[model samples]
Target: MPENDRLRNIRKETLSSAWYTLYRYDFEYRRSDGRWESRQREVYDRGNGAAVLLYDASRRKVLLTRQFRMPTFVNHNPDGLLTEVCAGLLDGADPEAAIRKEILEETGYRVEQLEKILEAYSSPGAVTEILHYYLAAYHPGQKEAEGGGVPEETEDIELLEFGFEEILEKVRNGEIRDAKTLILIQYAALFGPLRPVAREIQ
Candidate 1:
């Protein structure tokens, strides 16, 4: 089918472009019954991003980061401190390269072997962001510097490493609330290096 076969009168207006772009889209939509309806929706475009879950299979540990998020703070998150995998906006860079840089900047690990696992929209309803997810192995030798996020970006991140079981407990207790982090951890438990531990927990 043609991309716009079902509708017409599509138009968009830029609502804001201060930090990122926010667009208001007005279009006609074809319902299932073949009736056309006019609709309007707002979309926030902050560019695409990439994230990586750094793990140590030999020691059964995973590295994560803790940082404050203003959005979460205003949305009833008590402290707004989120525990998540190392992630960053692609900023026009390749997904793999972007994730590699993020791993170094947020966790101080110079990882070379990254396995791309998933690509997903951060929030499909209102945001235009596709997050590229990856998994990589890390060891003590890969720690080249103290990774606490870039000061220029006003990022104050704390590195956290936990045994596989301990991290799973955090997940069960709601300590790990970040969506990307939760998804990656669940993926690891189901099909990645943490499979054995997950099975044991069951």
Candidate 2:
């Protein structure tokens, strides 16, 4: 089917700047059969844009950043530490390129090749952010760059390299508390035909 014949019309688009930090919007549409639908989303409304989380398959490990999240601090935990994949807002660059750059900056591990595995909304009903997840294979080595996050961003980040089994344990224990991280870890665990249970100590 051609693009024009695929759908009927977009009924509405509501765009707004949120909390003076994020950009959020929604769209309402009508399909050919007169069905109405809507979706709410955000795209780096705070100028961060799109982001990628990478899994290094060759090393059987994942790269994550441990940083303080303000919201988490205010609402859930005081420390607000988040263990997440290398991610950043798009800043108008290509998503794949962004992932590669983020991997280098955050973990000091350069990724030569990246394979996109999934793209999903952070939270459609509330936040407009979409995440692009990827899997890249890399050999374990030293920091290829300065070794940590860009200081100006107040990102006192620590790089963590963990094998797949180790990471799944954290997830199962609720230690890897970030939503995106959880989703990506589960996706990688199920990458093959047989989805095995994550290894976690009881």
Best by lDDT: 1
Candidate 1: which pairs clash? Answer: none
Once superposed on the true structure, which residue ranges of model 1 sit more than 4 Å away at CA? 1-3
Candidate 1 structure quality by residue, lDDT tens digits, 13-127: 9999999999998899999899999999999999999988899999999999999998999999989998899999999999998988888888888986999999999999999
TM-score to true structure, per model: 0.97, 0.71
lDDT of 2 by residue, 1-202 (tens): 1224333333333355455344444555566687767755554444333344455555666667888889889987878887787788776788888877777777777867677877888766655567787766666664478647778867778977787677777877788877877777777677721134342322
Highest TM-score: which candidate?
Answer: 1
**Which window of 10 residues has the lowest lDDT sum in candidate 2?**
192-201
Question: How well does model 2 score by local distance difference test?
Answer: 0.66
Whole-model Cα lDDT per candidate? 0.92, 0.66
Report the C-alpha displacement of residue 66, candidate 2, in angstroms: 0.2
